[model samples]
Every structure is written in structure tokens, then in C-alpha cells.
Target: MRIRVDDLSGEATRSLIAHHLADMRATSPEESCHALDVDALREPAVTFWSAWDGDDLAGIAALKDLGAARGELKSMRVADAHRGRGVGRALLHHVMGAARARGLSTLWLETGTPPAFLAARRLYADEGFTECGPFGDYVNDPFSVFMMRLL
Candidate 1:
């Protein structure tokens, strides 16, 4: 699979991100959902990527520069057609490498704690991420699960 930086403006990319946003909304309550919309991912501080297998989009992920040697993982989603194929893992490593190259000291993320997010939580844990309190603009919340990993 090829994972590359994406501008989040292509038709296919827009469609995929829309699907991602829809899934987040469907999976969690409005107050708990933190998945970014396409417009948000296009902001200057965020660098988005899309993983593809030839002509098929396998997954999407992004990293936000939180400054102070810290980063935030955002918009991580594996497409329905590619969930069990390790696309998420590969994409995750790609983002991690980018963060390290940027000299970030740590990477943080916020994900839901419901059954729908079991796979994501497991992935983060397997990648050496540990539970933590909310960061950035986030506040304390029961439905939110925060994780962090040192780069």
C-alpha cells in the first residue's frame, strides 16, 4: 500500500473523509465525537494522509502539530473494504515516522471508549500508547479515552 500526504480536496478523498465523519457521528454521541471534518483537516496545522492500494483507497490518517514538541493524531480511519488488511497499522507507522522526523517529543490522541472503538483502542495500545488525560482543547469526559506515546 502507498501512503502519501493528501491535500484533502480530491473527490475521492472528500468522499472518504465524509464517510469517516459519518461513521464517527454514528458511533459516538455528538459531544464525544472528535473526528475532524474535511475542512478541519485542511487547516495549516494538520497534515493529512491517505493510504491506497493501486486504485483503491485503503485508509486515512492525519497528524496535527500541537507545538512544544508534541503532536496529535487525528482522523484515523480504515475504510470498510480494507479493515482487516493491516492498512491501519501501516498508515499509523507512516504518521509516527513523520512525527519523529519533525522532531516531536510525543504524540497524543483522543478516541471514544465505546465498543465501536475497541479496535482503535487496541491498535493504540499495541503501538505503545498509554492512557492519559485529555490534551489540547479537550476537557474531561467519560466517553473520551486519551492516549499518548513518546516519540
Candidate 2:
């Protein structure tokens, strides 16, 4: 799979991002959702990437600079067809590599605390992330679980 910086306006990437946003909204209410939409992903402080196999979009991930050698992982998702195919791992490794390259010392994320998100939580834990308190604009919410990895 090829992982490359994404143009928010790219058709395939945009569609994948839209699907990710919709999925997040469906599983977690808007108030507790932390996934960014295309416009927010385009922010200067955030670096977004899309994974592809040939011309097919496989998945996407983004890292948001949080200062003090910290970063936030956002909008990580693998296409439904690509689920269980390691696309998510590849995207995650890519993001972590980018974060390290950018001199980040920690990477963090907020995911749903619902049964539907159990797999995601497990994935994060397997990748060396540990449960943590809320950071940034986030506040404790029953619907959210925070995780972090010290790089």
C-alpha cells in the first residue's frame, strides 16, 4: 500500500473522509466526537495522509500538532472493504513515523467508549497506547476514552 500526503479536495480521499465522519457520528454523538471533517483536517497544524492500493483508497490518518512535543491522532479509518487487511496498521505506523520525524514525544487519541469501538481500543492498546486522562479541548465524558503513547 502507498501512503502519501493527501489533498483534502481529492475525490477519493474526500469520500473516505466523509465516510469516516459519518461513521463517527453514527457511533458517537457529535458532542463527543473528535474526528475532524475535511476542512478541519486541512488545518496547517495537521498533517493528513491517505493510503492506497493501486487506484483504490484504503484508509486515512492524521496527526495534529499539540505543541510541547505532543500530537493528537485523528480520523483514523480503514475502508469497510479493507478492514482486517492491515490497512489500519499501516496507516497507524505511517502516522507514528511522521510524528517521530516531526520530533513529537507523545501521540494521543480520543475514541468512543462503546462496544462498537472495542476493536479500535484494542488496536490502540496493541500499538502500545495506554489509557489516559483527557487532553486539549476535551473534558471527561462517558462516551469518550482517551489513549496515549509516549514515543
Off by over 4 Å in 2: none
Mark the 10 consecutive residues where model 2 has the least summed lDDT.
6-15
Model 1 C-alpha lDDT per residue in residues 1-151, reported as the tens digit of each score: 9999998778888898898888888978898889899889989999999999999989999999998999999999998999989999998899999999999999999999889889999999999999999899999988899999999
| Each prediction's TM-score versus the true structure | 0.97, 0.97
**How close is each model in CA RMSD to the real structure?**
0.8, 0.8
Worst 10 residues of 1 by lDDT: 7-16
Global local distance difference test of model 1: 0.92
CA error at residue 132 for candidate 1, angstroms: 0.5
Clashes of each: 0, 0
Per-residue alpha-carbon lDDT of candidate 2 for residues 1-151, written as tens digits (9 for 90 to 100) = 9999988778888998888888888988889888898889999999999999989999999999999999999999989989999998899999999999999999999999989889889999999999999999999999999999999
